[model samples]
Target: MQTTKKSSGWHLRDVIMLTLIAIFFGFIFWIWAFAYDAVAATPLKPFANDITLGAWIMAGPLAGYLLRKAGASFLGEFLAAFAEMIIGSQWGVSTLLSGLIQGIGGELGFALTGYKKWNSFSLVLSTLTSTIVTFGYDLYASGYTSYSLGMLITLFIIRFLSIGFFGGVLVAAITKLIDKSGILNR
Candidate 1:
């Protein structure tokens, strides 16, 4: 009989899987930080900054899909951010905070499903959720609220598209690839 890890909370396999996912994204996030800085320095910074936001949101859903549990996404994203900090992320401790918030955003989607559903709809919802929380955080933490309403709207749209594509669609594709390996089936 195949036991459900959801009702049992997390198993060792779940933890291991989440950890591996987190660690991988930690490195990616660390590298992405530099890319973000490079883009910020370019003339396109005004329009491109939000475009880069999605890269930060991937670990949560990827981990959640693999683990299929309530806190998997949050823990994965948190650990990933922790790794990014240890990897010398430019934002230092703030990166950790961002992870926490972003993880919550990812968690929110699954939570809305009452921890029952793990489908494409949930993934899209997860992307939208992360975009809202992270962008909402940025408004105050990053002083985006001081910007003009038009700029804020533009950033909002860009951030949504970025997360929708990179965090949502890209993560889904990666998850499908991993799923095809039958690792979860085993």
Candidate 2:
């Protein structure tokens, strides 16, 4: 039986792959954050709250699967937040904090699975984990408990969709694409 050191499993290629993916997603996250904030500030905000929770949920699993490491989700999200800051996020340091918590939530899902597996089921599980953690954070951070149960539930459902579809399905698809490219052939 060959035992592998946890961090030792990460090779130069792994770091590079994770770094590139983090930068890419971080850039996207910055753009998304800016657009979301802009739209949220508009009078049409109520009608424009279209992007669901599932989308956010998807990022963690997507990152975890692609990097196939316990820290990948965390690193990826942090990178995204860093990217947001570099791109001039109005939230400034707050975005970094949110990303840290959110990434930890997502990372926990895969970590619970022992980081020895990567699959659609794991991704879905990751989404669910992130949703619970992030939504709790929102409830406290944003004072969302003041909202009605129906509205809260609605938000939860949408968040699940966002995380599941975007983080789970989308991450899976991206990882598959990378695999096809033979970039991370391990």
Candidate 3:
């Protein structure tokens, strides 16, 4: 008799879960655009993107932790962005590019760990990498390079905080809840 190991590829249930997560977060991202605009209109406009970025980053880490697959984080973030575009996001097609960038950013941390650790430390690393990746993109795409060095430093700090809170802490909490619910065991 020959013995065979199970394939580690994505299954139907994983696809369904990923799609559901994308749709939900896509709508949330669309709604967040309005909030971003509102904040941009304020005196704190300079820091608005940093303030609201964490929410936009949630889906990647959330899906990564939940699915524990190699490309889950990237697909989660990208599909969510695609969904936001479909839902008439103010940013239109640019949202897709952002999603791609964000997805790669979110995936790097897990990749670094060989996709082994899904704990708080991994989450923190995810946030840090996401912040750095997104910030680098913003420097060129969003004209952040025009800002003064001090302002740039301030923006980096704010971005890290935002990503940490939403993508790291919040994701950790939500995953804990899901773990407690035992749905993944099914």
List TM-score per model, in order: 0.92, 0.82, 0.94
Q: Quick one: how many clashes does candidate 1 have?
A: 0
> Candidate 2: lDDT of 185?
68
- Per candidate, the number of residue pairs that clash is 0, 15, 0
Model 1 per-residue lDDT tens digits across residues 141-170: 988988999989989999999999987889
Tell me the tens digit of each residue's lDDT in model 3 across 1-186: 011123457788888889899999999999899899999999999999999999998999999998888888988999899999999989889999999999999989888899999889888999999999999999999999999999999999999999999998889889999999998897
lDDT of model number 2: 0.71
TM-score of 1: 0.92
**Could you tell me the lDDT of residue 18 within candidate 3?**
92
- Model 1: lDDT of residue 58: 92
lDDT to native, each model: 0.85, 0.71, 0.91
Q: Which candidate tops TM-score? A: 3
Winner by lDDT between candidate 3 and candidate 1: 3
Alpha-carbon shift of residue 129 in model 1 (angstroms): 0.8
Best lDDT goes to which candidate? 3
